[model samples]
Structure formats: structure tokens, C-alpha cells
Target: MNNQNVFYDELCLSIYTTNRYFHQLYQIVLGKYELTYLQYMVLLNIKQQGKSTLVVICRNLDLDTNTLTPVVKKLMIKNWIKREKSVTDGRSFELFLTNSAEQKFELIQIEIARIQEKLVGDDQQQFTKILSQTHTLNNRVQELIDELTNKK
Candidate 1:
């Protein structure tokens, strides 16, 4: 294979493998709260925004409604979030974190920090480097997605 193709293959494998590993870890940690990673993320967005419409949450998270809707439903069922008709725009639904979710998320945060410290283990520089690269990678992926989407 050519150098570029080899590099691309390695990058894809690394991303896929890392994602799977972290996903497993998240599942184990979040299972206590009956949350999947996506559900937790959606709740995190709502908590951050204080109160926001589904559209706003989706935009902020870069997730489409189709992917988010089911997770939202689960959160609602768990009483971790509530959906109400927007006062300003009745057609849209607003999302808010429940008191319970806020409490749980705080606990989740503490647990996550503990887990991260254990996993990262005094490698602050390496962790910082990974964080920087991951941000750049995500931005590049979004740009590529936009380019391909625009082509269609």
C-alpha cells in the first residue's frame, strides 16, 4: 500500500479501537444510573444549557434529531429530563434536567474524574496532547462531512 493509504488505515483503526474502549468504560460507569453514553451526553447538554429546545441541544451536540429522539425518550422515562412545549414557540419542545438528573450528573462527574485519573495516571502532558489532537481531528471530520454533504 502507498504511504497515504497506510496512514489512513492506521488512523481509522486507532480511532475505532479507542472509541470502542472508551465506550465500554462509559457503559460500565453509566450503567449505575441506567444511562448509555448518548443519554448522558444529552443530559449533559441540557444541564449546561440550563433549559433549551431540542433543536438547540441537537445543534450544540452536533447530533441529528433522529439519533437524539430515542435517547430523549429514555431520559424522559427515567425522569431525568422533561420536555415541555416552548413558551415562545409552542411548536418546539424544550428540554430541562430534572433535580434527580442534576444530582446524578454531579455524581457522574466525580466518578468520571476518578476513572480518568486512574486511566490517565500522571500523564498530564500526554493527556493534554491527546485532547488537543482530538479537538483538531473532530473539527477536520466535521469539515470533511460538510464537504461531502455539500457535494450531494
Candidate 2:
């Protein structure tokens, strides 16, 4: 195989491994709260964005609606979030945190901070730099995917 192919394969493997490792850590930290990484991410995003639509959640999380639908349903059932039809947009519904979700948000934030501190410790500067670089790379990858899909 060509060097370019080898590089791409290695990069993909590294990304997958990193994601898996972090997910395992997240699972451990969030286990007591009965939340998965994706679920917590959805909550956090909604909390940050303040009354977001399903399309916004899907886009922010880089997940499809099918994958997010069940999670949102679960959250609604748990009384951690609520959904309501947008007054301006009849087709879209907005998501907002419930009282319980707001109460738990600070605890979740503390746990995540602890986990991050444990993992990165003194190397936080390097971790921040690497995370920034990863964001740039992810955007580039998305652009490439969009270009390829458009071509097809």
C-alpha cells in the first residue's frame, strides 16, 4: 500500500482508540448518574445552547437524528428535559432542561472536571493545544466529506 494509505489508516486507528479510551473513562465517571457519554453530551449541549431544536442537537453532536431520538425520549421520560413545539417554526420542537436536569448539571460538571484533571494533570496546556488542533482537523475532515458527497 502507498504511504498515504498507511498514514490514513494509522490516523483512523488512533482516533478510534482515543475515542474509545475517553468513552470508557466517561462511562466510569457517569455510571452512578446512569448516563452514557452521548447522553451527557446531549444534555451539556442543550444546557449550553439554551432551548435547542433536534436539528441543532444533531448538528452540534455530529450525530444523526435516529441516534439522538431515543436519547431525547429517555431524557424526557426521566424528567430531565422537556420538548415543545417552536412557536415560530411549527415543524421543529425546542429542547430545554428541566428542574432536575438543572440541579444535576453542576454535579456532572464537577465529575467531568475531576476526570479531566486526573487524565491530564500537569499537562493541561498540551491537552488544550491538542484539543484545538483536533477541532481544526475535524472541521477539515467534515469539509472533505461534504465535498466528496456533493461530487457524488
Candidate 3:
């Protein structure tokens, strides 16, 4: 195979492994909260974005509505999030965090920090570099996606 093909294969495998590891670690830390990694991601996004709609959440997460709807329902049932019809768009509902979600976010931050500390050990610099690289790569990937989608 060509070097580019080999590199692509390696990159794909690395991303798959990294995703699995992160999923396992998230489960270990947030299992008690009864939230999956995706669910936590949705919550975090809403917290950061103030108020969001289901379509926005799905777009931001690169998830389909079918996959996200059930998770939103679960969060709603737990009262961790509130959903209401958007005045601007009757078909879309706005999502917001409840007081319980705020409390949970605080706890999640502490627990995540502890887990991150343990995972990084003494390699704070390496961890920071990796995070920076990941963010850059994510942005690049999003740009690629936009280009491809625009073509369609």
C-alpha cells in the first residue's frame, strides 16, 4: 500500500481506540450519574451554548435525531434538562438545564478532573499538548465536513 493509505489506516485505528478508551473512562467516572458519554456531551453543550434546540444539539454532536431523541427524553425524565417548544420554530424544541443539572455539572467537573489527573500522572505538558492537538484536528475535520456537505 502507499504511505498515504497506510497513514490513513493507522489514523482511523488510533481514533477508534481512543474513542473506546474515552468511552470506558467516562463510564467508569459517570456511571453513577446514569449518563452515557453522549448524554454527558449533550448536557455539556447545552451548558456552554446557553439554550439549544434538538437539531442544533444533533448537528453539534454529529449525531442523528433518532439517536439523540431518546437520550434527550431520558435526561428530561430525570429532570436534569427541560424541553419546550421554541417560539420561533414550532417543530423544534429548546433545551435547557435544570437546577439539578447545574449541581451535577459541578460534581462531574471535580470527578473528571480527578480522573484526568490520574490518567495523565505527571505528564501535564504532554496532556496539554494532546488536548491542543485534538482540538485542532477536530476543527479541521469539521471544515472538511463542511466542504463535503457543501458539494452535495
lDDT of predicted model 1? 0.88
Q: Relative to the unseen true structure, what is the C-alpha lDDT of residue 125 in candidate 1, on a scale of 0 to 100?
A: 94
The candidate maximizing TM-score is 1
User: Considering only N, C-alpha and C atoms within 3 Å, which residue pairs clash in candidate 1?
Assistant: none
* Model 1 agreement with the true structure over 35-120: per-residue lDDT tens digits: 88888888888888889877887888888989888889888999999988889988988899888888889999889889999999
Which one is best on lDDT?
Answer: 3
In terms of TM-score, which candidate is stronger, 2 or 3? 2
Whole-structure CA lDDT of model 3? 0.91
Per-residue C-alpha lDDT of model 2 across residues 28-118, encoded as one tens digit per residue: 8778788888889999989998899988999988899999999999988888889999999989899999988898877888988998888
> Which residue segments of model 1 deviate by more than 4 Å?
none
Residue 65 displacement (Å), model 1: 0.8
The TM-score that candidate 3 achieves is: 0.75
Error of 1 at 43 (Å): 0.6
Clashing pairs in 3: none
The number of clashing residue pairs in model 2 is 0
TM-score of 1: 0.87
Weakest ten-residue segment in model 3 by summed lDDT: 143-152
Each prediction's TM-score versus the true structure: 0.87, 0.84, 0.75
